[model samples]
Target: MRFFISVFIILTSIAPAWSDETRLDYSGRTVIYHSDVKLRGSQKRDVRYSHKANFFGAVAINTTKKTNDSNGAAWGYHNLKTAQDNAMRSCRFKADRPEDCVLYLSVVPKGFDFKPKTRTLSNDAVEAYNFLVGWSRLNFDSYRSFAVNGIHTWAYSASAPTREAAEKEALEVCEETFARSQKKKDPAWAKAVYLKEHLQCRIFVTFSPV
Candidate 1:
Protein backbone atom coordinates (compact mmCIF):
# COMPACT_ATOMS: atom_id res chain seq x y z
CA MET A 1 0.00 0.00 0.00
CA ARG A 2 2.79 2.40 0.80
CA PHE A 3 4.52 1.65 -2.49
CA PHE A 4 1.30 2.23 -4.38
CA ILE A 5 0.79 5.52 -2.57
CA SER A 6 4.31 6.62 -3.40
CA VAL A 7 3.83 5.76 -7.05
CA PHE A 8 0.60 7.71 -7.12
CA ILE A 9 2.35 10.75 -5.67
CA ILE A 10 5.12 10.52 -8.22
CA LEU A 11 2.70 10.24 -11.10
CA THR A 12 0.65 13.15 -9.83
CA SER A 13 3.73 15.30 -9.50
CA ILE A 14 4.76 14.60 -13.07
CA ALA A 15 1.31 14.99 -14.61
CA PRO A 16 1.10 17.33 -17.61
CA ALA A 17 -0.60 20.65 -17.03
CA TRP A 18 -2.62 21.57 -20.07
CA SER A 19 -4.26 24.95 -20.37
CA ASP A 20 -7.55 25.64 -22.16
CA GLU A 21 -5.65 27.13 -25.06
CA THR A 22 -2.24 28.42 -26.08
CA ARG A 23 -1.11 31.49 -28.02
CA LEU A 24 1.92 32.07 -30.19
CA ASP A 25 3.42 35.51 -30.28
CA TYR A 26 4.79 37.17 -33.40
CA SER A 27 8.17 35.64 -32.66
CA GLY A 28 6.67 32.12 -32.45
CA ARG A 29 6.95 31.99 -28.71
CA THR A 30 4.14 30.00 -27.12
CA VAL A 31 2.15 31.52 -24.28
CA ILE A 32 -0.50 29.74 -22.22
CA TYR A 33 -3.85 31.33 -22.78
CA HIS A 34 -6.96 30.49 -20.78
CA SER A 35 -10.34 30.12 -22.39
CA ASP A 36 -13.64 28.44 -21.74
CA VAL A 37 -13.38 26.43 -24.93
CA LYS A 38 -11.35 23.32 -24.37
CA LEU A 39 -9.62 21.19 -26.92
CA ARG A 40 -11.20 17.91 -27.88
CA GLY A 41 -9.90 14.81 -26.19
CA SER A 42 -8.26 13.56 -29.37
CA GLN A 43 -6.63 16.91 -30.03
CA LYS A 44 -5.35 17.04 -26.48
CA ARG A 45 -3.96 13.54 -26.87
CA ASP A 46 -2.15 14.56 -30.05
CA VAL A 47 -0.55 17.45 -28.23
CA ARG A 48 0.33 15.37 -25.20
CA TYR A 49 1.71 12.32 -26.98
CA SER A 50 3.40 13.90 -29.99
CA HIS A 51 7.00 12.66 -30.06
CA LYS A 52 7.72 11.21 -33.51
CA ALA A 53 10.67 12.53 -35.50
CA ASN A 54 10.33 14.14 -38.94
CA PHE A 55 6.79 14.95 -37.95
CA PHE A 56 5.78 18.59 -37.68
CA GLY A 57 2.37 19.85 -36.59
CA ALA A 58 0.60 23.11 -35.85
CA VAL A 59 -2.65 24.41 -34.42
CA ALA A 60 -4.35 27.48 -35.81
CA ILE A 61 -7.19 29.49 -34.33
CA ASN A 62 -9.15 32.57 -35.22
CA THR A 63 -8.45 35.22 -32.61
CA THR A 64 -11.23 37.52 -33.67
CA LYS A 65 -14.03 34.98 -33.21
CA LYS A 66 -14.67 31.41 -32.32
CA THR A 67 -16.62 29.03 -34.50
CA ASN A 68 -16.97 25.32 -35.01
CA ASP A 69 -14.54 25.48 -37.89
CA SER A 70 -12.44 28.43 -36.82
CA ASN A 71 -9.78 26.27 -35.15
CA GLY A 72 -7.82 23.33 -36.51
CA ALA A 73 -4.87 21.11 -35.74
CA ALA A 74 -2.62 19.27 -38.16
CA TRP A 75 -0.05 16.66 -37.23
CA GLY A 76 2.07 13.87 -38.70
CA TYR A 77 3.38 16.06 -41.48
CA HIS A 78 6.90 15.65 -42.83
CA ASN A 79 7.50 19.40 -43.08
CA LEU A 80 6.96 22.22 -40.61
CA LYS A 81 5.87 24.77 -43.19
CA THR A 82 3.45 22.28 -44.68
CA ALA A 83 1.95 21.52 -41.31
CA GLN A 84 1.56 25.21 -40.53
CA ASP A 85 0.01 25.97 -43.88
CA ASN A 86 -2.41 23.07 -43.65
CA ALA A 87 -3.42 24.01 -40.11
CA MET A 88 -4.12 27.58 -41.18
CA ARG A 89 -6.01 26.41 -44.22
CA SER A 90 -8.14 24.07 -42.15
CA CYS A 91 -8.85 26.83 -39.61
CA ARG A 92 -9.71 29.47 -42.19
CA PHE A 93 -12.08 27.38 -44.26
CA LYS A 94 -15.08 28.65 -42.32
CA ALA A 95 -13.61 31.56 -40.39
CA ASP A 96 -15.39 34.88 -40.73
CA ARG A 97 -12.06 36.65 -41.20
CA PRO A 98 -9.45 34.22 -42.42
CA GLU A 99 -6.75 36.82 -41.82
CA ASP A 100 -7.39 36.54 -38.09
CA CYS A 101 -6.36 32.92 -38.12
CA VAL A 102 -2.97 32.59 -36.48
CA LEU A 103 -0.79 29.72 -35.49
CA TYR A 104 -1.26 29.14 -31.78
CA LEU A 105 0.78 25.98 -31.30
CA SER A 106 3.55 24.27 -33.23
CA VAL A 107 4.96 20.79 -32.84
CA VAL A 108 8.32 19.81 -34.21
CA PRO A 109 10.35 16.65 -33.92
CA LYS A 110 11.27 15.44 -30.45
CA GLY A 111 14.74 17.02 -30.71
CA PHE A 112 13.84 19.95 -32.92
CA ASP A 113 14.78 23.41 -31.71
CA PHE A 114 13.08 26.66 -32.57
CA LYS A 115 16.40 28.49 -32.06
CA PRO A 116 14.81 31.81 -31.35
CA LYS A 117 17.17 34.78 -31.44
CA THR A 118 16.21 35.69 -27.89
CA ARG A 119 16.42 32.05 -26.89
CA THR A 120 13.87 31.36 -24.14
CA LEU A 121 12.81 34.99 -23.92
CA SER A 122 9.55 36.56 -25.08
CA ASN A 123 9.37 39.81 -27.03
CA ASP A 124 8.90 41.63 -23.74
CA ALA A 125 12.20 40.24 -22.51
CA VAL A 126 14.01 41.46 -25.61
CA GLU A 127 12.64 44.95 -24.99
CA ALA A 128 13.76 44.71 -21.37
CA TYR A 129 17.25 43.69 -22.47
CA ASN A 130 17.46 46.67 -24.81
CA PHE A 131 16.36 48.98 -22.03
CA LEU A 132 18.87 47.40 -19.68
CA VAL A 133 21.71 48.01 -22.12
CA GLY A 134 20.86 51.71 -22.21
CA TRP A 135 20.38 51.92 -18.46
CA SER A 136 23.70 50.19 -17.79
CA ARG A 137 25.51 52.70 -19.99
CA LEU A 138 24.33 55.52 -17.69
CA ASN A 139 24.71 53.57 -14.46
CA PHE A 140 28.04 52.05 -15.18
CA ASP A 141 29.18 52.12 -11.56
CA SER A 142 26.14 50.34 -10.18
CA TYR A 143 25.65 46.61 -9.98
CA ARG A 144 22.95 45.31 -12.31
CA SER A 145 21.08 42.05 -12.81
CA PHE A 146 18.74 40.67 -15.46
CA ALA A 147 16.23 37.95 -14.69
CA VAL A 148 13.62 35.99 -16.60
CA ASN A 149 11.06 33.35 -15.73
CA GLY A 150 11.64 31.66 -19.11
CA ILE A 151 7.98 32.06 -19.93
CA HIS A 152 7.48 35.35 -21.72
CA THR A 153 8.39 37.47 -18.71
CA TRP A 154 11.49 39.32 -17.56
CA ALA A 155 12.74 42.09 -15.29
CA TYR A 156 15.97 43.93 -14.51
CA SER A 157 17.49 45.93 -11.66
CA ALA A 158 20.13 48.62 -11.95
CA SER A 159 19.59 50.55 -8.74
CA ALA A 160 21.20 48.03 -6.42
CA PRO A 161 24.86 48.40 -5.56
CA THR A 162 25.50 44.70 -4.81
CA ARG A 163 25.08 41.66 -7.02
CA GLU A 164 22.92 39.80 -4.53
CA ALA A 165 20.66 42.82 -4.01
CA ALA A 166 20.34 43.36 -7.73
CA GLU A 167 19.42 39.72 -8.31
CA LYS A 168 16.86 39.76 -5.55
CA GLU A 169 15.23 42.93 -6.86
CA ALA A 170 15.21 41.61 -10.39
CA LEU A 171 13.65 38.32 -9.29
CA GLU A 172 11.01 40.09 -7.26
CA VAL A 173 10.12 42.31 -10.19
CA CYS A 174 10.06 39.42 -12.64
CA GLU A 175 7.98 37.14 -10.43
CA GLU A 176 5.52 39.89 -9.65
CA THR A 177 5.05 40.67 -13.32
CA PHE A 178 4.72 37.01 -14.12
CA ALA A 179 2.09 36.48 -11.46
CA ARG A 180 0.11 39.55 -12.50
CA SER A 181 0.12 38.53 -16.15
CA GLN A 182 -0.89 34.99 -15.39
CA LYS A 183 -3.63 36.07 -13.05
CA LYS A 184 -5.00 38.51 -15.58
CA LYS A 185 -5.00 35.77 -18.18
CA ASP A 186 -6.59 33.05 -16.03
CA PRO A 187 -7.46 34.06 -12.53
CA ALA A 188 -9.11 30.78 -11.58
CA TRP A 189 -6.27 28.43 -12.46
CA ALA A 190 -3.22 30.62 -12.99
CA LYS A 191 -2.27 30.90 -9.32
CA ALA A 192 -3.19 27.37 -8.35
CA VAL A 193 -1.60 25.55 -11.27
CA TYR A 194 0.39 27.56 -13.82
CA LEU A 195 2.24 29.87 -11.41
CA LYS A 196 3.02 27.14 -8.93
CA GLU A 197 4.08 24.72 -11.64
CA HIS A 198 6.26 26.99 -13.82
CA LEU A 199 7.28 30.10 -11.88
CA GLN A 200 11.07 30.15 -11.56
CA CYS A 201 12.86 33.44 -12.09
CA ARG A 202 16.63 33.27 -12.41
CA ILE A 203 19.21 35.92 -13.09
CA PHE A 204 20.57 35.31 -16.55
CA VAL A 205 23.06 38.19 -16.84
CA THR A 206 24.83 40.44 -14.42
CA PHE A 207 26.93 43.57 -14.83
CA SER A 208 29.86 44.65 -12.69
CA PRO A 209 31.77 47.88 -12.90
CA VAL A 210 35.26 47.66 -14.32
Candidate 2:
Protein backbone atom coordinates (compact mmCIF):
# COMPACT_ATOMS: atom_id res chain seq x y z
CA MET A 1 0.00 0.00 0.00
CA ARG A 2 2.81 2.43 0.80
CA PHE A 3 4.53 1.65 -2.49
CA PHE A 4 1.31 2.22 -4.43
CA ILE A 5 0.65 5.51 -2.67
CA SER A 6 4.17 6.67 -3.32
CA VAL A 7 3.93 5.74 -6.99
CA PHE A 8 0.63 7.60 -7.30
CA ILE A 9 2.12 10.72 -5.76
CA ILE A 10 5.11 10.63 -8.06
CA LEU A 11 2.90 10.20 -11.12
CA THR A 12 0.69 13.13 -10.19
CA SER A 13 3.67 15.40 -9.50
CA ILE A 14 5.14 14.55 -12.88
CA ALA A 15 1.94 15.42 -14.72
CA PRO A 16 2.40 18.05 -17.48
CA ALA A 17 -0.14 20.56 -16.09
CA TRP A 18 0.84 21.39 -12.52
CA SER A 19 2.39 24.79 -11.88
CA ASP A 20 2.79 27.12 -8.88
CA GLU A 21 1.60 29.98 -11.03
CA THR A 22 -1.57 31.73 -9.80
CA ARG A 23 -3.42 31.87 -13.11
CA LEU A 24 -7.20 31.38 -13.53
CA ASP A 25 -7.96 32.68 -10.07
CA TYR A 26 -9.29 36.08 -9.14
CA SER A 27 -7.15 36.10 -6.04
CA GLY A 28 -5.82 32.53 -5.86
CA ARG A 29 -7.17 31.46 -2.46
CA THR A 30 -6.60 27.80 -3.40
CA VAL A 31 -10.44 27.84 -3.72
CA ILE A 32 -13.54 30.06 -3.73
CA TYR A 33 -12.97 33.33 -5.60
CA HIS A 34 -15.41 36.18 -6.04
CA SER A 35 -13.54 36.77 -9.28
CA ASP A 36 -12.25 34.14 -11.71
CA VAL A 37 -11.13 34.61 -15.31
CA LYS A 38 -9.70 31.85 -17.42
CA LEU A 39 -8.01 33.99 -20.11
CA ARG A 40 -7.38 37.49 -21.29
CA GLY A 41 -9.70 39.21 -23.73
CA SER A 42 -6.65 40.51 -25.51
CA GLN A 43 -3.03 39.55 -25.28
CA LYS A 44 -1.54 42.84 -26.48
CA ARG A 45 -3.41 45.41 -24.47
CA ASP A 46 -2.68 43.39 -21.36
CA VAL A 47 -6.09 43.79 -19.86
CA ARG A 48 -9.77 42.90 -19.70
CA TYR A 49 -10.47 46.63 -19.63
CA SER A 50 -14.15 46.90 -18.85
CA HIS A 51 -13.94 44.51 -15.94
CA LYS A 52 -11.29 46.66 -14.26
CA ALA A 53 -13.47 49.71 -14.01
CA ASN A 54 -16.50 48.49 -12.08
CA PHE A 55 -15.36 45.27 -10.47
CA PHE A 56 -12.19 46.49 -8.80
CA GLY A 57 -13.45 49.95 -8.08
CA ALA A 58 -17.21 49.89 -7.63
CA VAL A 59 -17.52 46.57 -5.89
CA ALA A 60 -14.72 47.40 -3.49
CA ILE A 61 -16.16 50.85 -2.94
CA ASN A 62 -19.61 49.40 -2.35
CA THR A 63 -18.35 47.07 0.30
CA THR A 64 -16.50 48.49 3.27
CA LYS A 65 -13.17 49.76 2.04
CA LYS A 66 -11.24 47.21 4.03
CA THR A 67 -8.71 47.35 1.22
CA ASN A 68 -8.05 50.04 -1.34
CA ASP A 69 -5.17 50.33 -3.76
CA SER A 70 -5.86 53.94 -4.59
CA ASN A 71 -6.78 56.95 -2.47
CA GLY A 72 -4.44 55.95 0.37
CA ALA A 73 -5.14 52.37 1.50
CA ALA A 74 -5.23 53.43 5.14
CA TRP A 75 -8.36 55.42 4.42
CA GLY A 76 -10.12 52.30 3.27
CA TYR A 77 -9.20 50.50 6.46
CA HIS A 78 -10.65 53.33 8.42
CA ASN A 79 -13.95 52.92 6.64
CA LEU A 80 -14.11 49.25 7.57
CA LYS A 81 -13.62 50.22 11.19
CA THR A 82 -16.65 52.45 10.89
CA ALA A 83 -18.85 49.79 9.23
CA GLN A 84 -18.53 47.63 12.33
CA ASP A 85 -20.37 50.32 14.26
CA ASN A 86 -23.14 50.98 11.69
CA ALA A 87 -25.11 48.92 9.19
CA MET A 88 -23.18 45.64 9.37
CA ARG A 89 -23.69 45.77 13.15
CA SER A 90 -26.70 43.56 12.73
CA CYS A 91 -24.90 40.62 11.09
CA ARG A 92 -25.39 37.35 12.96
CA PHE A 93 -21.79 36.16 13.06
CA LYS A 94 -20.57 39.15 15.04
CA ALA A 95 -21.09 37.40 18.33
CA ASP A 96 -20.64 33.63 18.56
CA ARG A 97 -18.67 32.76 15.39
CA PRO A 98 -15.27 31.23 15.79
CA GLU A 99 -12.65 34.00 15.67
CA ASP A 100 -9.85 31.80 14.44
CA CYS A 101 -11.06 31.59 10.85
CA VAL A 102 -8.60 33.08 8.36
CA LEU A 103 -9.37 35.15 5.31
CA TYR A 104 -7.43 36.64 2.35
CA LEU A 105 -8.02 39.75 0.24
CA SER A 106 -6.34 40.35 -3.12
CA VAL A 107 -6.57 43.16 -5.61
CA VAL A 108 -5.37 43.05 -9.20
CA PRO A 109 -2.26 45.22 -8.70
CA LYS A 110 0.49 46.25 -11.14
CA GLY A 111 4.23 46.44 -11.76
CA PHE A 112 6.18 49.49 -12.78
CA ASP A 113 8.42 49.98 -15.85
CA PHE A 114 11.72 50.33 -14.01
CA LYS A 115 11.11 47.62 -11.37
CA PRO A 116 14.12 45.23 -11.81
CA LYS A 117 13.99 42.06 -13.92
CA THR A 118 13.27 39.76 -10.97
CA ARG A 119 11.81 42.04 -8.30
CA THR A 120 8.03 41.88 -7.82
CA LEU A 121 5.02 43.62 -6.26
CA SER A 122 6.03 42.10 -2.95
CA ASN A 123 9.61 43.22 -2.79
CA ASP A 124 12.08 41.88 -0.23
CA ALA A 125 11.91 45.13 1.71
CA VAL A 126 8.61 46.73 0.77
CA GLU A 127 5.29 45.09 1.65
CA ALA A 128 2.96 46.40 -1.09
CA TYR A 129 -0.35 45.06 0.17
CA ASN A 130 -2.97 47.24 1.83
CA PHE A 131 -4.44 44.25 3.68
CA LEU A 132 -3.37 40.66 4.14
CA VAL A 133 -4.96 38.07 6.43
CA GLY A 134 -4.02 34.53 7.33
CA TRP A 135 -6.63 32.60 5.39
CA SER A 136 -8.43 29.30 6.01
CA ARG A 137 -11.08 27.25 4.20
CA LEU A 138 -13.50 27.98 7.04
CA ASN A 139 -13.61 31.77 7.26
CA PHE A 140 -15.83 33.01 4.44
CA ASP A 141 -18.51 32.67 1.76
CA SER A 142 -17.92 33.09 -2.00
CA TYR A 143 -19.61 34.37 -5.14
CA ARG A 144 -18.61 34.65 -8.83
CA SER A 145 -20.22 36.85 -11.44
CA PHE A 146 -19.29 38.34 -14.83
CA ALA A 147 -21.56 40.57 -16.85
CA VAL A 148 -21.57 40.93 -20.64
CA ASN A 149 -19.15 43.88 -20.60
CA GLY A 150 -19.37 44.08 -24.36
CA ILE A 151 -18.14 42.14 -27.39
CA HIS A 152 -15.00 40.18 -26.62
CA THR A 153 -11.94 39.93 -28.84
CA TRP A 154 -8.15 40.19 -28.95
CA ALA A 155 -6.09 43.39 -28.58
CA TYR A 156 -2.55 44.41 -27.75
CA SER A 157 -0.71 47.39 -26.31
CA ALA A 158 0.09 50.24 -28.61
CA SER A 159 3.52 50.45 -30.23
CA ALA A 160 5.94 51.61 -27.58
CA PRO A 161 7.29 55.14 -27.53
CA THR A 162 10.70 53.75 -28.36
CA ARG A 163 12.43 50.40 -28.80
CA GLU A 164 14.07 50.88 -25.45
CA ALA A 165 10.66 51.59 -23.93
CA ALA A 166 9.14 48.51 -25.56
CA GLU A 167 11.85 46.18 -24.30
CA LYS A 168 11.53 47.61 -20.82
CA GLU A 169 7.74 47.24 -20.94
CA ALA A 170 7.99 43.54 -21.81
CA LEU A 171 10.48 42.82 -19.07
CA GLU A 172 8.52 44.78 -16.50
CA VAL A 173 5.32 42.94 -17.33
CA CYS A 174 7.07 39.57 -17.19
CA GLU A 175 8.62 40.21 -13.81
CA GLU A 176 5.72 42.13 -12.28
CA THR A 177 3.08 39.67 -13.43
CA PHE A 178 4.83 36.89 -11.52
CA ALA A 179 3.22 38.33 -8.36
CA ARG A 180 0.91 41.19 -9.28
CA SER A 181 -2.08 42.81 -7.52
CA GLN A 182 -5.22 44.63 -8.78
CA LYS A 183 -5.51 48.29 -7.92
CA LYS A 184 -5.71 51.24 -10.30
CA LYS A 185 -5.88 55.00 -10.34
CA ASP A 186 -5.77 54.94 -14.12
CA PRO A 187 -5.40 52.47 -17.02
CA ALA A 188 -1.91 53.42 -18.19
CA TRP A 189 -0.29 50.19 -17.01
CA ALA A 190 -2.11 47.71 -19.22
CA LYS A 191 -1.52 47.70 -22.95
CA ALA A 192 -4.45 45.45 -23.73
CA VAL A 193 -7.57 44.79 -21.68
CA TYR A 194 -10.55 44.13 -23.92
CA LEU A 195 -11.81 43.57 -27.43
CA LYS A 196 -11.63 47.29 -28.07
CA GLU A 197 -8.66 49.56 -28.66
CA HIS A 198 -9.53 51.83 -25.76
CA LEU A 199 -10.28 50.07 -22.49
CA GLN A 200 -8.82 48.12 -19.55
CA CYS A 201 -9.68 45.27 -17.19
CA ARG A 202 -8.87 44.91 -13.51
CA ILE A 203 -9.68 42.52 -10.60
CA PHE A 204 -9.71 43.04 -6.81
CA VAL A 205 -10.29 41.10 -3.54
CA THR A 206 -12.15 41.89 -0.31
CA PHE A 207 -13.19 40.26 3.00
CA SER A 208 -15.93 40.89 5.56
CA PRO A 209 -15.08 40.37 9.22
CA VAL A 210 -17.56 38.75 11.56
Best candidate (score: lDDT): 1
lDDT of 2: 0.20
TM-score for each candidate, following the candidate numbering:
0.46, 0.15
lDDT of each: 0.52, 0.20
**In model 1, which runs have C-alpha deviations exceeding 4 angstroms?**
1-118, 187-197
| Per-prediction CA RMSD (Å) | 15.5, 23.8
| Model 1 agreement with the true structure over 50-71: per-residue lDDT tens digits | 3232235566666665543446
Q: How well does candidate 1 score on lDDT at residue 96?
A: 70
Clashing pairs in 1: none
Candidate 2 lDDT by residue in tens digits, 26-95: 4321111222223222221212221231111111111222222110111011111221111112111222
Report the backbone clash tally of model 2: 21
Decoy 2 TM-score against native: 0.15
